[model samples]
Target chain A: MQHALILIGVLIAGMGLSVEAGLLGPLGEQVGHLSATLSIFMVGALLLSLALVFTPNRQLGTLFKQPRWLLTGGILGPVYVIVLTLATPLVGVGMTMVGILCGQVAASVAIDHFGWLGSEQRRVDGYRVGALAMILAALWLM
Target chain B: MLLPFIFLILLAGGAVLAAQSSINGRLGAKTGVIESAWLTFIMGAVLTFLLMFFFEPAHEATLFSVPKWQLTGALFGVVYMLAIVFAVPRVGTAAATVAVISGQLLMSLLIDHFGWLDNTVRPLDGSRYLAMVLLIGAIGLIYLSHQQRHRRMVNQPG
Candidate 1:
């Protein structure tokens, strides 16, 4: 029951990306692609900051001391976007997306198998591979 | 020559991305979802601004030059960020990541077929229909695996 809801939540989040991509293109065209990309983070930061201010008991400072590497998430976010932008024009969006999806599945499986980044160990067996194969094949067609 | 290298980089970048989601999900479960999200956005904002200053070429229009409504698009990012942070802790990173990808591909096909939001019209064909079927099959398989796991755990003793 709980897992289903989480699945829905991530799905909605994924759908939001599609919408964001739609908006981002025109915004990029208007403000310049890079600047528009900046605006996403800027605006999101501002909004989230306002949200954090109102919410009580934020442990922001505590997070800094946990492990420096954990903070790489922030850095990775922008780097992924920049790399995608660079890859898109050169390889075409279809091929670029296929590459990313392939990477995502491989990395996810490895991370799960090794329990990297504190994720629980979940072995990739025939079932997982079959599902992933379907996803990759679908990605190729799309 | 360079193309393979670029593709390799993309693959690495994609790996780090899944890593990033898992890391942020850990942070979210610890520091709070909004806090984790805020940190990433602030850090991203600063980094992108620096890149813009040093590397990005000048363009004809600025953010203010565009329609005000267009800016709301960034909010969707907040949704995506928060969703990953919230979902990853409950569901494993692999499940959450694939689910998100499934959602993205599903909606993207819709957008392409309809030509919504000023995108080029690319009507769906047979392969596209098959893609949707296979994509759903993938999601279903994942869900079934989760169900099997849950049943196994339930049957086991503490």
Candidate 2:
């Protein structure tokens, strides 16, 4: 039951992403693509800072001392969005979306299987593969 | 070679997204979601600003030059970051990632069909409908398997 709710919540978040993409497309035309992306991060950071002031941040000393590799998340987020924006024109949206969906599922499965990055191990078995195949087929149809 | 390279980058980009979600989720669990989100955004904001400043060519229209409504798109990103940070810890990365993709596909189709936000109308067809159904099925399968594994872990005796 709890899992179901989380799934729905993420799904809705995904919808918001589509809306973001739509809004950014025209903005990108006006103010350069990378600049548009910068706007997103700046705005997000600004909002999160406001949120922190109200909520109070957790211990900062602990965060800084953690593994340096963990900080890569900040870089990864922008890289992914920028690459997708760049690739869409070259490869077409359908193909680009397929590549992204495939990569995400494959990486997610690998992460779960190998227990990388502190996630629990979930094996890459026929069941998982079947789900992946469905996703691929779905993408292909789109 | 160039085509393959672009595809490779796209794949890497996608992989990075999953990794980011998983990593950020762990960060959220440790430092609080807002704190972790703030860290990534601050870092990302700085890095992208450099990229924009040094690499991006000058344009006729600036952010201020454009209609103010366009800038609101940035707010949705906050929604995505917050959602992923909160979801990943509870539901594991694969499930959350797939669910987000499913949502994207569904919503994009709607936007295309309706020509919302000035996107060209790409009328929905049978294949699009089928694609949505298959995606839903995929989500259902992933969730069920995830539940089974979770239950097994909970029931295991020490």
Candidate 3:
């Protein structure tokens, strides 16, 4: 039952990501790149704020006091959006996403194994390495 | 032109690393997704604002001039973040990512091919489908390997 729930969650997340990326292509077409990006982040910020207000889990202080390691991760948020937007114009959304996914999976393996930036380290072995390599090769082929 | 491409690659790499870092932080200690997400956006918005101030004056100027309809992209971001928090643990990162990419490719094809937003036409073609297949296969293989590792760990003596 837990596994099933997880699978459903994965599908929902995937669909959400896809829709977001899809919207980007069109949004970029309508608005200039910077405006599109700023708007998305602004809206995201607004939505998250609203979620915090309505939900009891609002830990604004905890989030503010986050360590440098976690704070560093915040940098990626905007950078990712900007990159995806730029890449869409250059390589098209499909290819750009392929590149991003390749990078992401590759990075995920290391992050999972070593737990860099103050993360909890996990076991690393041949299976993990091989899997990541295969994914990279597949990205290249694709 | 090349600069933007380079920046994009760097940004993608950064985002991946950042995500993993966040997960690691969660595993190591208690972390609130909403709080973390809010901080991330606030910081990101500030950073981008600064970058705009220093680098591209003309582009920055146009940002305020745009109509409200252009802000629709934000709705997508809200959905995407919600999906991440919900899906990452259940499906594993690789599988969940592939699913997202598949959705993106399909949607992008439709939008690009038809110029759905009154933009230039860039029809979907063979290469796109081929890319999707590779991503799916890659994700499947990764998950299979993960299962094997889990089995090995279980079989090992404590």
Candidate 4:
């Protein structure tokens, strides 16, 4: 049940990310693409700061302590926004999303199996491989 | 034609990287929901800033000249992140993913077709609908695979 919950969480997160992407797409259409990208992250940073301020339990110091990890993870945010923004204008939102999902499945398999960068090691088995294949096939069809 | 495909691939790669970071952030044994969110965004922000440093913008005023309306999109991200943390534990990953994608597809269609969020009106066309259908079908297949695995596990002796 716990495992199932985690999986569901990831999926929901993915979906949320997707919708978030869709909203940004139209916003990008209005603001120049680069400006839109910067604004999104800047706002994201501001939002996080506000959350940290309002939510007393979380320690800002903890985030600062591990600068390397935070930096590495932080870089992904902008890269994701930029690449996704770039992709949308070039290949429409739908195709760019398909491509994004394809990479997600492929990278997820490795990340799960190898436990790279301090991730929890979830062993990849036949079931996972089969699931991956299905996702890939779906991307191809998309 | 090919350029779009290439761009898509790049987008996918970025998404994957983002996913890996999420997993990593959660790996912290004592991390809670808010902490996880904070770490993910903080890390993501730093990376974005660095990239901005190296990649000179085509428009000089890009960083400073953001419009007020774009800020609304940030609220969407916040809501989406919260939904993810809340929904994942209830529905299971595969099912939740399908539901979320389904919602996104439906919403995206409306946005694109109606020109919501200040977009140029691009009438929903056949090709766009076809692409969405394909995406939905793909999400369905993923769910089926998960179900098959679950059934096999249930049938197996502990």
In TM-score terms, candidate 1 sits at: 0.95
| Candidate 4: clashing residue pairs, number | 12
Q: Write the per-residue lDDT of candidate 2 for residues B31-135, one digit (tens) a residue.
A: 778878889999899989988889899999998788888888768888888899999888788888888989988999999999999889999999999998998
What digit string (tens of lDDT, one per residue) describes model 4 on residues A1-142? 5544544455445545545665665555554554565566667667867777788676555644553653354455566666676566777766777776666555555554575655444455554555555445534543
**Model 3 regions lying over 4 Å from their true place:** A1-8, A25-31, A81-99, A118-142, B1-29, B59-69, B86-99, B109-131
Q: Taking the tens digit of each residue's C-alpha lDDT, what string does model 1 give over A59-111?
A: 87887877887777889987888888888889987778888878887898788
RMSD vs true structure, all candidates: 1.5, 1.6, 4.6, 5.3
Q: What C-alpha lDDT values do all the predictions have?
A: 0.86, 0.86, 0.57, 0.55
- Once fitted onto the true fold, the runs of candidate 1 whose alpha carbons sit more than 4 angstroms away are none
Model 1 chain A weakest 10-residue run by lDDT: A119-128
For model 3, residues B1-158, the per-residue Cα lDDT tens digits are 58566645754664464374345235224456676666666666777666655654353335456565555666766665555545554444444444455445445555667876555687656775665565455545546655766677799955
Question: What value of lDDT does candidate 4 attain over all alpha carbons?
Answer: 0.55
Clashing pairs in 3: none
List runs of model 2 lying over 4 Å from the truth.
none
The deviation in Å at residue B150 for candidate 2 is 2.4
Q: Taking chain A by itself, what TM-score does each prediction score? A: 0.92, 0.90, 0.76, 0.78
lDDT of 1 by residue, B1-158 (tens): 88899889889888978998999999888889998999999988999999888888777878888777788877999999999999888778888888889988999999999998888999999999999999788877777878877787899955
- TM-score, second chain, candidate 4: 0.63
Query: Top model by DockQ, which number?
Result: 1
DockQ of each: 0.79, 0.78, 0.40, 0.31
DockQ order of candidates, best first?
A: 1, 2, 3, 4
TM-score of each: 0.95, 0.95, 0.71, 0.65
